[model samples]
Target: MDEVRVFPIIITKNKDSSEYPYFVEIPDIDGMTEGKSIADAMKMAEDYIGTFSLENKLPDSNTKLPRVEEGAVVTLVSVNVSEYKRKNDNRVVKKTISIPNYLNELGKENRINFSEVMTAALKKKLSV
Candidate 1:
């Protein structure tokens, strides 16, 4: 099951630049990220919040919305922290496993990718 957290974000158009125009502010994490469009900005905000939540403890969503200025949009961004981490965390660690000598020799001879096989087996066993 995915644990979803919703955070409020303020998006404003960047008048200074046209290439990357949308700017997002995630107040809960005190984080800021920008994107090329509104949808992109929202996605970036979600990613920022997810990364922040994974790294640090996050406070409960603020019930009282922040004051919105003219031409600024306030919206809720929901992120599944667990799913986000699973999708975004790519750091790999080495693990030593003991396999039968014959199987190991066969795998080497067949040029099998042990990492891919292990990952697929684990994912299947875990039903992820």
Candidate 2:
């Protein structure tokens, strides 16, 4: 099957800060061999669907998976989000932020530039 025939995967930011090269996992398939990233995962899915069709003796074309027969319990697989930000800091985008009064006061007391303090805070939060 072509990449277009496979179910679309969702991508999300990882919450675990300790890990570098922020990674995402796919959950719909029995195993996570497919759909593990925004780009690579999509490619993997295409490969997987193609392999599945070949193994099942189906035409090697983009086609929806056939539904199970009636009276059989179908185990629906839930699609999971897959994506990760690149490990490199070059991916970072600069943005101006408005600091709250309390935060601004804290930065002033700490002898920190308001923007610098906020940038540090963001860096800590993002673990970059």
Q: lDDT of each model, Cα atoms only?
A: 0.88, 0.41
Give, for candidate 2, the lowest lDDT window spanning 10 residues: 76-85
Q: How does candidate 2 score on lDDT?
A: 0.41
Angstrom error at residue 116, model 2: 66
lDDT of 1 by residue, 1-128 (tens): 87888888999999998888999998878899998998999999988988887679878766456899999988888888889888878788799989999999999999999989998999899898
- The clash number for model 2 is 0
Q: How many backbone clashes does candidate 1 have?
A: 0
Query: Model 2: per-residue lDDT, tens digit, 29-51?
Result: 43234333445544554455344
Clashing pairs in 2: none
